[model samples]
Target: MSDVQINKTKLTYDYIIVGGGSTGSTIAGRLGEKSQNSVLLLEEGPRDKSIYIHIPVTYYKTAQGPLLKRYNYQRSAEQTPQHEATMVQAKVLGGGSSVNAMLYLRGNSSDYDDWEKAGAIGWGYHDVIKYFKKSEDNNIFHNKVHGVNGPLGVSDCAYKHNLSRVWLKACQEYGLPYNPDFNSGEQQGCGFYQVTIRNGRRSSASKAYLSNRRDNLSVETGCKVLKLIFEGNRAVAVEFIQNGKKQTAYAKKEIIISAGTFGSPHLLLLSGLGPKEDLEQYGIPVVKDLPQVGQNYQDHIEMSLVYKLKGAFSYDKYKKLQWQAVAGLQFLLFNAGPATSNIIETGAFWWSSQGKKLPDLQLFFLAGAGIEEGKDGVPGGNGCTISITQTRPESVGYIKLQSADPYQQPLIVPNYITAPNDLKTLADGAKLVQSIMSQDAFKDYVESSHVPEKPLESSEDFENFVRNEAYPGLHPCGTCKIGKDELTSVVDPELKVHGIEGLRVADASIMPNVISGNLNAVTIMIGEKAAELILNS
Candidate 1:
């Protein structure tokens, strides 16, 4: 990537974008295409230069590494006794795209349709598919739903473990049909996932959008924006800290906040654009009293079922020095091996209960257990994991300002599985996965369950397991939702902030509801659509 420093004297630009993440990077690249439009992108984190950020298999390390910022969360008081739950947000130029497993899922088409029905006009499946295609450069499947010449690269996994293939066959033998493409708008059935990897390296938003030198676009990293500088409800500038020095930058035309789900709403609340009572409590003068600014939080929650393997058939064997050396040499020589795999490559989508029109559960089959932090391996040191996720959860939460300090982490409450239906759906999904793993196809490879440790013979067993073991899917969104008015939403259909002039929000935070799949692809699509809206406006 080019290292073009921002001129201290020339701090004004036509468009100023906060947060150089997936959405922010895309907007900067697209808006900079027009030389007349000067765009400035500011990221609080450093540049995406770490080796871990570029490799496909280093996701496990980068996910918990310093490139991410962890925020402590909790369930509501009525749900259970207070316990510590944590969620991580990206803190690099490419955001989650730089650190995530790189799964390229757009969710079921009905997800966008549901967004449209819920007041996000002009955002239905048909309306938003073009944007999804607009940013993609698929190495395979040159069809209407996939794009070929876009900056972001989408390709099939270069390597898959033998056990991963076996899991796919077992899912099919258990009932699901093989799905060739999940991004084709139909997300049901078992299949291998396409990823955001190109040439065996991660195709992060920073590499895709900001790698090329653009004279019109200037990206400044390690700059933490303190607050929006408003002039009579018009956000014209931002005051921030850079290199331990406070600085101010002016926007000639507009300012767009693309700070993801948590940061975006936290920025708004810090800038006095949220609930009047909450702002007053923190001594922040109310600028818009938009009650929905930090409300309507949503996320996907998942629970894993781990099973021991009869032998060293999975990637767990590679933890040894000899196998690690072999795998390293294979990748360095031919760009292939276990190192080329993203680990969570194969997955399936199906209903948690019968007679449901759409699938409410998504399952990911990992070739090795104890791969991710907070997970365990079996006594024999050979195991695999199947994680079941509730795709469309009914539970809602919020993000509130912990204090007036911009550096303080926000109060994040995902309230995961607080809703009765969410718990039931997850329990049902676990049962379905249990049945799939029990199929004869897995008999040669599997031994016994290692997580639940015992057979869950009753509904209560499943429910208790889900409640105790469920974790965040890391797909947080909907804090700054899009809708028709200020009473219920933070931004309008055009993505412009309600009642605030010259300010817009374009990120996953504006999602009316969380999609039924991963958020990275859809978040990039939002950046594509947001740029178009701004250009048209």
Candidate 2:
């Protein structure tokens, strides 16, 4: 294998952030701002200058386009008894941000409170609320809960896609109250979704923090990080490969693994830092016997209840030039059109009548049916979908190293819908969605529900359907969980990995438990908070 030569004489730096997608980019930007410290950001993909990534609607085409390389981590058909196919994450520079549908959900306040209850200290809703506001530049609510100016822009979607007014009407008709903003102090009602778009384009974390500061940071895209270089237990460097050539770079101060839930843990195990037996099988010299590095993988699973629309409201116009021209003109002038919509999600947060506390289920009212698992995270095509997900699932999954080589894909066993309660919570959410849809308010929009449209006659029927067709919410997290115990937790409360120095994880991987809603905004906030902690420390 070809190797890129680097002198250890020039290896010293203040910090080195790996996986420059969402969190990595933010950490690098924030650290680079400190003139006293130098930072390097290494990404395993192309440079962050894709025109398609910037344009929100154009992103739909780019997600599966040629520019985004496929990097699905496949498991043996025998290994994952639960899953029948391979799972993938974006390999391009922006990571999942380049491929994920730009839905900007901040999760719920109670979700954070639960983390504290789970023993992740100092992570209460009240503690992190300021950080949430600190990272947001909300175009809608400039209240005490939201910030007016921040690096991360959280705002009303750039477009008012069709079905906005109708969606709100359908919610009220279903008795699910209309909520103007979900990110405000209280999040309890159905409302239009806020997207990570600015001026009709996708405003990914890379877009927000990676640009305009290239000179100070060294970014390595199209380079797969192989492993970390350790000396007497201190992580001193990182080894990577690009264009079929191996390369090595050192971090004088810190080595942050922001390579998502799968990549980060997989890299750790390959570096001889996970379960000892697994490392031995892979012929990796054991560095640390951390048994829980890849353990506790969590994701939100949902079953989409499809619906055939009543009229031309479906994205059928996407193929026609007349509508395309009109959408382009609308966005160019006002940044308000279907092109800017991340699809309006109008629904509710109601209990199952069984729960005594806040609702643990979220009901999404998508305007159409989606088919086929495409490269883009967005569900395919125009059919309304109601996704019933477990508010808090007790089941946990894991990621493991398949080989010592960095090019080799890791083993991702999501073990989705494993627990009996996970299935029950989903059924509860689905029942709520069905009740709302059956209401008279949605009569104008409701033509008919497509699959399993009628009321699920029995619990067995609901559970059977959910187990068969349940899809991932694309909010995978918690492999590198944080807590007080070093035995089970990967990162401590300060985001530092126990028994490891000069290393920290700054992504959704640090979530103690998966949040109730979309995790993109939460991950971004984690990035900001990690940076703050590092700077202050």
Candidate 3:
């Protein structure tokens, strides 16, 4: 059956929300709730309501499974020909929220503060905290920082394998405090991972925010939106293709783009709203000639270190009965068990393990290992993982259009570790990971560092390892950067493209600098706030 109820592209809407992912789903539902406003949501992939998608424990399988990807993206590092990129994104209905680790986390306190300082008017920490509270429903760990009856359900992992406990002890032994909650004022700790799961199922934004209104909201999936059809600088409609046939859909009030960091800019460029030179190179007509549409791309870079443990661990070990049985019991019963784990055992924020002025690095601990070069699975012996990432790297790269075709993949050149400071940050983070791993707390539990276990015998060895091992975070941002300067900003503080009318961007692309944590929650908040701004306007 078709997901769309109406067919005419000329039908006007009070609001047209493109890309029905987390933020798109939230904004669309919020707008539709008013009863007076009409909203239409366009998604490129199929429905994101797979059985595995709802089961939080099986999210790992979803990430590695065939049903997850829509775009085939891979980039090669410039310094190392052998070290490839690990860029995975869920292209289905709910977008990444359906396929991610499902961990529930708002970024560090300063992330929103940075956005406010960067001229993102009315987006300070104080402003966004209310939205965060409005979006979540915490089953556990409730306090000043959490909300009890929100749309998104937040819960602690049901399935706590033995290794996660080891990680906590290791942290305690290594002088890392066991922070009971990362969502509170600070996020530095080794404790249970929190997930967006309710009764053992994934509670994605679409499932939560768009829960009961599937029928009222006009949604068209499997329809790849090509570009906005503008009438004299005003966005009148969007052109898309479904089942190999072209279609146009109009918006009377506005067309909001939530195509994420990659899709948003690419669509803008195709719509003739991007830099003139890039549009000319592809022989596409230029509309507004905004140069910053695809420039200033930023993302966190992570290098996974998997280890072979003494006993079997379950998060990725698919063999053990305890793991399999728990997964089943959790789903069938109270929805508690291995299926509840978000897989991010514990995460922390710290200064560039190299002592930078800002806490620009992050650490993640997982209960499984063996994902070498981003593809290898866990071995059965028993293991867990730790990752060191440059939370805000100085390096910048961009996405370029290969052609005007919607099916063609955009040219994604991340230019990983191009700047000297980027390399320095990663190396320092690597060193810090080494220090944490070697501390007496973790030393008793951890056998040896799997990737760089040799005590970094020399600086050259560490640098070489970093250059070859570093990978781009799935959290790509700033492609359609938000700044005041015409030379660098794509959208103004209000998220409207500088030279266009009846249009705006509401996605991670508007982030000026990559925040120091997983960026999913912040992106959803952006959509919510953007809708309010647009509705008020």
Model 1, position 520: C-alpha lDDT score:
94
Please estimate how well model 3 matches the true structure, expressed as its whole-model Cα lDDT: 0.75
On the 0 to 100 scale, the lDDT of residue 478 in model 1 is 96
Per-residue lDDT value at 375 in model 1: 83
The local lDDT score (0 to 100) that residue 185 gets in candidate 1 is 71
**Per-candidate total of colliding backbone pairs:** 0, 8, 8
The number of clashing residue pairs in model 1 is: 0
Ten contiguous residues minimizing lDDT sum, candidate 3: 1-10
- What would you estimate as the lDDT of candidate 2? 0.71
TM-score for each of the candidates: 0.96, 0.90, 0.92
Q: For residues 328-387, write the lDDT of model 2, one tens digit per residue.
A: 888789867777765543555666655636667777655544422431112233456566
User: Tens digits of per-residue lDDT for model 1 on 1-537?
Assistant: 122235865477789999999989998888888778888899999999998787788787887789988888976643444577677889999999998989999988988998998899999999998988889999997888988899999999899889999999899999999999988878889999999999888999989988988777889999999999899999999888999999888898899999989899999999989999999999999998999988899999988999999999888898889998998898899988888888899999998764568889999989998866578778899999999888899999998988999989898888788888898999999899889999888999999999889768799899888878888889999999999999989999999999999999999999999998999998899999999999989
Q: What stretches of model 1 exceed 4 Å from their correct place?
A: 1-10, 77-81
Report, for every candidate in turn, its global Cα lDDT versus the true structure: 0.89, 0.71, 0.75
Candidate 3 matches the true fold with a TM-score of 0.92
Off by over 4 Å in 3: 1-9, 70-78, 82-86, 141-144, 313-317, 320-323, 370-373, 378-380, 439-449, 453-455
Candidate rank order under TM-score: 1, 3, 2
